[model samples]
Target: MGSVNAISKPTPVNPRLSSLPGESFPVCIIGLGLIGGSLMRDLAAAGWPVFGWNRSAHTVKVANRSGFDVSGDLDATLRRAEAEKALVVLGVPMPALPRMLEAIAQHAPSVGFTDVTSVKAEVHELVEQHGLTDRFVGGHPMAGTANSGWDATMSGLFDGAVWVITYDNAKNRGQRGARLWLDTWRRTVQMAEAVGAAVVPTVARRHDSAVARISHLPHVLAEALAVTGDMGGPLSLTLAATSFRDGTRVAGTEPELVRAMCENNREALVKALDEALALLQKAREDIASPGQDLHRLATEGHAARMRFEARAGRKVKDAPRRPIIRVQPGAPGWTDQLSSAESMGAQIGIF
Candidate 1:
């Protein structure tokens, strides 16, 4: 924390990245919002030179006050990244990514590009449109709260959390920078692990669908729950219990952030919501049936929820942390062994 400029080529935190000699290459985070600012702080703490760019002057002031080397000039930052082949992490909103992707593609094509957005397939489209699929790996660090901005960020937030990294070697190996792709993967995992996240390799579409059910749907439901009850009622606040308070916790997240996520990936979210609705309907019917023996839905729901909670706490012992699912543009049946429909191919062995 003394001097950001005094950093060195970071040591590899994991054996898989042992051969990646220290280039002392810095990482440039394009946004200084909660995720981006936290990443910069953690990377700098790990002895990697870190630079950041943010649009808001107040945000820049806050970052500089926090001792981060944030620049208001994005063009200069991108040029610096070009010179060092520094990895770029885009932590901006989903809609802002395409323009930034195009810029990174044109100005910093040599460096590896990744993101912290929950949605993937949309960005995958932007990556392909800009011919950046090879140089960019889609990512989502499952570490966040109902907060935003630098002050809201916690440096150790990602600790013990799941960070999903997308992998693909579908590109022809003959491409000029094909080998660098592997280096990018190593550096990405290395940096992610440095921040205390347990890396999980997954496909983009698979990640989107799983997050839709596990993450996105929860936000929508929480917002609805928070708004459904009468605020005017005198007993409304007094009647709330731990369940009510905990269930609507995510409703406190910034409206824009919630809106962006729900709007961007609504297709997948709608499907998950539909399933949730059907299950609720079944439970409703079962509750209406006075027969104690016909409460099958309730029993199934309890067991299902318990099974999820069980796996959520268990870490894979022999599971390979490297690329678990490979995604190629037209690779036939790639999903056959890797679909979330089949437990998200979590059992697929890493080669």
Candidate 2:
């Protein structure tokens, strides 16, 4: 209900904290769901200027009681953001984006904008639709659990997680106003790193495509797997163990959230789903025909899993250090350079 700065928290001296123009830019997060709430917790804990908003006054009260500055009033929250020059983060679901963006455009049009939305391209389109592109940076933090709401939130959720910061450079193809665009990108990256996340610079389309397979498709598969396990009946349910739990972990996410994630990224998800179906169809055919070995599927799957484990382990086990690659905004082909570096597993070290 109060301004973000109304509560004073000393900024912790952290090497992970990137040097911003103002040292620490205040973050106003709208929607106090799991991702937003967890972000608020981590940023506030790290001594950054942060506050949040949720439509539910009860959720706001809970966050407030837990010492987070939160407002249930959208207009007041945006007013504070405008007054303090805060960077506004949209943490609501895809279905709620339009209304949130409209309110933001009306109340705090000049503030820097970013989001933790699961899908990036659609959000980017919506931002562009509302003429909020100038100070906007598309972002999606690749973290979260099969949980929802304020109570499900926990600090450090993004610790060592891949927090994607997206920029479609083509949008700035001939524009001279790269400073604000670049600053927005840097601010989002700084905030992500401040919460112990590794920043991956990318474009909105690529982000959507990649997440379709890695993030969204998994939810679809998990739902199918869960149902298959349930169809196995009482004995099978009783005997289900690690594999079932691991495979269906994301199936426990709020159904509406899963729908939004998959439905919003429909095109990419369909492509991913088609590929998955092809693989399954081959397996089915192999099983139906006697004497046909499942060696190809089994071997390829094993190798793929192994490769993933190796890559993921390296990322997670690596020491928390600043990004090693730097990309300048206005430089020629800088966006392409960042994308190229990202392809090689390099993160943005300096803006």
Candidate 3:
């Protein structure tokens, strides 16, 4: 693995220093994929100026046409961000994080940065090793569709989603700069609220474990289902129903990205799979027995699913403050929707 070299350390200023109210900050997004593009849309709609960069010129062009200020040159984007004292959002893959940090330290040292990568521990270590800890935060927006790329982005993608922010104990030690961070948090919360997702706070390890169970495990299960059905005759597959289709939905994900996430988070995923297998084995054993309490187990599974749904619904309702921006039944013009939100005292971010 490549390592980042340490640079000169800055004086230990209080990390918890307060932020001024209504202060506008420039944001630099390094990727124009689904998450980055959606973030840009939300930030721009909320009236924040944004600068975007992508490895592909075509991606940048598409973002520019969609009303984002995109730069094809990485150096130029860094220069622009340094000039504006911006917050840089890294939306690259896990394996790309070390090099990205090195590049940022070399070209954009003055800008504060954050990443949207799913796995946090390794990336967090890289940021610290590069002596950019204070100026960086780990962000993982818990929202996305099965789609990828800028063209798949929608302004409401993050609405009502939990965007996890992770840091070392150092960053959250005081309440001083908590408000400034909260301003950024508030913007993200509003974005989630607008999209219909609930915001939840969690530590990195916790986030990884939870997602491994709910998200990663499901992808694995979907792949297993798809593979099993492949062994069946074509006629059998033709008779698959809605539940079969839905259950195997994520099996169609981009192969590379899915493989990367699974490999990177293998430990947590393995543990989750073990637990799931144990439960399945118990169910199987019960079904094999003539006098098995099949009804009880079925009831237990149903009750568990109901509890999960209820908790998820309650969390969504409790996460955000009142006065959320509501979208009508039909798709309206972007400007008109934004204007409506602004009039209702809702902060909206559009990229």
Candidates sorted by lDDT, best first:
2, 1, 3
Residues 216-289, model 1: lDDT tens digits: 89999998788875463658767988988998989888888888888889889999999999987777777777
TM match of model 1 to true structure? 0.81
Local distance difference test, each candidate = 0.73, 0.81, 0.66
Per-residue alpha-carbon lDDT of candidate 3 for residues 1-351, written as tens digits (9 for 90 to 100): 122221132211111111222334678889878898888887676556678898888888777787689988887788788788777889877777777888888888766677888877667678769876656656778778878888888876765566665533224423544433433443433333433444344445666777789888998999999888877879769998898899898998998878988887787899999998988888898989988857867898899999677546333434444233433211345335534543443433323
lDDT of 1 at 104: 85
**Off by more than 4 A, model 3:** 1-23, 169-197, 313-351
lDDT at 133, model 1: 74
Cα displacement (Å) at residue 162, model 3: 2.0
Model 2, 60-154: lDDT tens digits are 88888888999999999998999988989999888788999899989996778898888888888888898878888888888888778999999
TM-score of each: 0.81, 0.87, 0.75
The weakest ten consecutive residues by lDDT in model 2 span 13-22
